[model samples]
Target chain A: MLYLSTISWLQEGPFALYRWNSLKEDLPLFFHAFLYTIGISLGALALAFVLGIFFGILSATKNKGAVFLSRIYVEFFQNTPLLIQIFFIYYGLPLINIVLPVYLIGILCVGIYHGAYIAEVVRSGIGSVPRGQSEAAASQGFSYWETMFYVVLPQAWRMMLPPLTNQLVNLIKNTSTIAIISGADIMFTANSWSSMNLNYVPAFAFAGILYFILCFPLAKWARHMEEKNKKAYSR
Target chain B: MIQMEGVNKYFGDHHVLKNISLTIEEGEKVVIIGPSGSGKSTLIRCINGLETITDGLITIQDIDVTKKEAPIRNIREKVAMVFQNFNLYAHKTILENLTLAPIKVKGIKKAEAEKTGMEYLERVGLADKAAAYPAQLSGGQQQRVAIARALNMHPEVILFDEPTSALDPEMIQEVLDVMIDLSKINITMIVVTHEMGFARTVADKVIFMDDGAIVETGTPEHFFTSTENQRAKDFLSKIIHH
Candidate 1:
């Protein structure tokens, strides 16, 4: 039934946008939005990683206060909805004289939201290293920070990479959330352009393809890393 | 060089070490033998501040181990430990593992530390495996590398915590051989092991523990044959007969 309906819609509906000449005209606008999406994703990714690593190390430390502070950051950002965060930064912040640019708002909201998830990935990565590793380092007179820098982090980095790449993929896909704020990202372009020309199917389908192009390779690489990590300790 | 006075340790409600008091003289090779879960590992672990005592005092060369403000790092620099699993940094090559602590903790020059590291690796008969990662080596080879890593620290005291228990039967002798060679030096050695042969050959003093207390302390002959403590006798019989 679904297939028959789709075929009938293709034959009888306003599907003129699928024509090559019309698509060719819309390609440049889509490409620009694609680049914009990439830009916001990269900026947000940088912010996320910085916050992630900082909070990751903070949570992993032995200090109770440090761990507690990171716990609060992780919990607050993780439990709340990302769309709500984006709305508050983009719409509500301006009410209190804190008018951030749309681009900055997109970066901060998305970055901080995913930063919580990345922080968890990092904490678990560091935790996965054998306790004996740190004990050995301590017995050799290594300071806590020195042990982390020299022994623990190097081992943990291998464990962290696959998960961290996964977080990067999530961060990229989440850049679409910026569309609601009129950030001119790929999703926004698809919405606005398709509405104007009544070409929702092609525009939305191509927008998905663009996101797949950005995200699929990263997700695939993360799976590859996870596979390699399984055999990392074996001869 | 190490003294424990009424050291007590508890894991929540369960007591793990009780009224432990002993002294390890400089350059003396002391071997601790006991059944599993007898707190022998915990005792030596306390000497280096790895497991904090619940009550009482432990001092290494006049440095108080139980004091919160004590110089634990300084004590660790002088006291090295060899673990049963030979916890070499799996990410680093053998040579890198050997040189890491000296260069980082002692602030030694890289070249000088590498030279000393190579010498210790050669001493442990693993100079050829310097470029190898820990996972690339057999259990015996890895433990030998661990010993080499510890010796590179030039510690005044070395603690061996069941160092050969993790190796295959064919591999235990190789690691024990490295440790036997280590005993000839003038550094204080505290060993916890089930190997009666190693204790007989290398130990100047032997101690037996059970139920979180030192049950017997004596020369190897006294510990192996003449131990009057019933718990030590039972432990000896079980391990020796098998």
Candidate 2:
């Protein structure tokens, strides 16, 4: 009887954290932020894919200089924290008179950060293909680029799809970093709305649910692709 | 014709091919036999510029293979190779695999390449399997498609690097049958294999290698019945008995 009364007090008293009336009033704002998050994620994902493929091919090539350049790009982006990258783009660049719009900064930093990981995924995908596939292409007089386009990339694409989809899921989650810069994404809206009303529990819980809505299907699809790839060559 | 003069290859500190000189005439059928890692495959691979020779001069139809600036693709255009593992493009249908090189490298019309591809598939008796993926076929069927792929290129020479070595015992005969039929055509053939019977029946010249060196070069009769080299004799006995 005592524990039940305490629970009710926490739920409805002055110390209450999740007020249904307040949350209902802010639902439209949260919905708008959700849309903004989707826009940022889609833009960032496109940029990441472009950079990933370019750097991945550079790393996979036999040329020493190209591989070296790609390694530098991947290492620098992968080693540093995404927060620092975001802060640098948002705050540090202003001192140097290179101010970017908040949305642009969010897309650029998250896109470039995830681009390094996607490049690795792409490189390993290409590496997973047998050496004989390229050699056989060479024996038939296909040039290096021709072999990649016609034979190697088509095969590597199959192996890459699952990991690439997973990367996209990660990309969507990482867009939350836009909140720290006060970009009007879902996390930003949740942080601001919760601070005003001290409703942190319901605020964060709903934010989590929104993110899950975006990512769960992608993660599930990746698992399906991985399973199918395992059976690809089997009778 | 293909020519090699004092070819030597090294993998880091290990010597793979010693000072070797050989000549292959046009339309000649030459079979190379040796123990594994004896540089027989390396020798043929060097001819088509697949493996770089450390120090040597190799020429195919007057194209210098040793020169970096030379048109190696031109040489590859003239010479096709069938690998031990078949190495078919796994993502492509068998017919697409056959037509890819001819259309891409030779700049043959897609229609004409498809026509040639179907003809070669028919030659290898795999016309029915043309729509199948490499993974969907048996080891022997894939090798036949690989052979048909080489034939689609209309190459002046075909290099067979242990084409039947990776097949099941029951399937070896199918791949060999295609190669024997191939030898009847007027194209230069350089094969590296352990199939002594195929060598005896089809090879115009047989070269034996041991320890990165050409131990003997002779006709099949001389190699099979009258070779005086102790190493060749020993190798023959072990292979024949096995």
**Could you tell me the TM-score of candidate 2?**
0.90
Pairs in clash, predicted candidate 2: none
Model 1: chain B TM-score relative to the native chain B: 0.99
* Share of native C-alpha contacts between chains A and B (below 8 angstroms) recovered by candidate 2: 0.73
- Candidate 2 lDDT score at position B133: 84
For model 2, residues B1-242, the per-residue Cα lDDT tens digits are 88889999999998999999999999999999989999999999998889998997899987899898979788898999999999999988899999998888999999999998999999999999878889999999999999999989999999999999999999999999999999999999999999999999999999999989999999999999999999999999999999
lDDT tens string, model 2, A173-209? 9999989999999999999998988887778888999
What's the TM-score of every candidate structure? Answer: 0.88, 0.90
lDDT of 1 by residue, B1-242 (tens): 79999999999998999899999999999999988999999999999889888999998988898999989888988999999999999888899999988888988899999999999999989899888889899999999999988889999999999999999999999998988998999999999999999999999999989889988899999888887888888888888789
Best by TM-score: 2
CA lDDT, every model vs. true structure = 0.90, 0.92
Native-to-model Cα distance after best TM-score fit, residue A54 in candidate 2, in Å:
3.5
